[model samples]
Target: MSFKTIAAILQGEQEFQRVLDCAIPLASRLEAHLVGIHAEVLPVPYTAAAGFPDTDFIQVSTELNKEATLKLRGTFHERVEDAGLSFEWRTLESFSGDGTLAGLPNVRAADLIVAAQRDVESDDGTDVESLVYDAGRPVLMVPHSGPILSSFRRVLLAWNGSREAARATFDALPLLIEADQTDILIIDPPESSDDTPDAAGSRIAASLGRHGVSVGVSVRNSQGQSVETLIQDRLAASGADLLVLGAYSHSWLRELLFGGVTRSILRSAPVTVFLSR
Candidate 1:
């Protein structure tokens, strides 16, 4: 499937420009309708110890939010117009001040979502796992610091033959079809009664091959290395621009409590990561 509508979740000023740096060109190339979504925080009423309202606090908060909202809206429009792409700009005001959360309705309607990795120093972050798990769509996360390529030449697809793995592969078909090379990497593949160890990633490789993806498979023993580490090394070694994987292959609670591959990679990875639930 091709992307017809692309939503760029602009979390804040510091990082949204970088996200648009990737999204604008992609939308232009795909000829998709691009939507920029931002949300302003609604100030809550403040009261002093004497039960009197703090007008200064409320007014300052309100003005700051409005200023930020206006600034982002202006920048988004200017970039889209400069790119000459069909687009829409959405703005919202809510207590959470989360652009991603506020834009859920629009995000659900889009074919794909683009989000950025969090920059802790600047508080430029979003609940990206929600976008992956809740959006019922594929999400491409750009690293807060990395080389953002106009086009992905090599794709590293982590496959384990699980339902989630299968979902991510097909979801990434549009890019896989266009990529110069796609390596299906399976680490510590499970021993199956019906399939041999050597045949682990072959089926999916064949499936993607049929879709015009130049594909290959790499089955390896983790050798005491964590799955996330092995995957990271593979991306760097292969010079891959993209890493596609199933998000939360384990149960969400288990992953959250004990730590898991999804969380590890999401926290930091050198390449742009593509995820699907």
Candidate 2:
């Protein structure tokens, strides 16, 4: 029920330090093995003027990437050692130039994955948006803006009675068990044959209560507003720092055709988000 190993996705020098700030303290609190994963893009063997293999271009590119990677490695050691926390650094060469996609195998092996949410204003992020859907593990996405949280004190769990929501609720058990309070939110619940709309969140609340989590259920009327909008409003009011969400409860095609809750939240969540598929 506790995270034994946490893989922090370090994407170059852009925000590696911020990612570490979120990962290190949590790892220390959980006493988990912290893994630092970074990927360097391999030089593409494009043709020269004469269409011959350009060795010089490849060699220079390789060296430059290596130099940057080594520097990042040094930074990792200096910070982690200073904290007196156990850690391991992993580096890989990605042909696709996407570290998040390249480190899938290693990330899958860990108990949890910590990633930075893509900066909504910039297009420079290295495929960080795809990590949540593809990782097959619960991902804690740190917001690119706002105050970084060293601990998750208040939590908000979004529930819709879907399989994805169920998976997310259980995946967040470790954190919920430690939180001071957890609120389950269900918006505009549909009529169910087995359960009533009033009790939509009640069942889940009772289940979580068994785990010793201080839990409460809240049902809100969306009132024509988007689900993401209401969720964000609640987050601001409740002052919850962490949001536990089930990603892609609907099909991929369905989400693409119509705007999805998962997609909207991923792009614009103000606080840290815990996403599970």
TM-score of each: 0.96, 0.95
lDDT tens digits, residue span 120-239, model 2: 788756565478778888898888888888578899999998899999999989999989999999999888797788878888899999999999888998989999999999999999
Summarize candidate 1's per-residue lDDT along 38-79 as a digit string, tens digits.
Answer: 878888888988899998999999998888888888889999
**lDDT of each candidate versus the true structure:** 0.86, 0.87
Top-TM-score structure, candidate number: 1
Clashing pairs in 2: none
Off by over 4 Å in 2: none
Clashes of each: 0, 0
Q: Which 10 residues in a row give candidate 1 its minimum summed lDDT?
A: 118-127
Model 1 vs. true fold: TM: 0.96
lDDT at position 1, candidate 2: 79
At residue 193, give the lDDT of candidate 2. 91
Question: What lDDT score is found at residue 56 in candidate 2?
Answer: 95
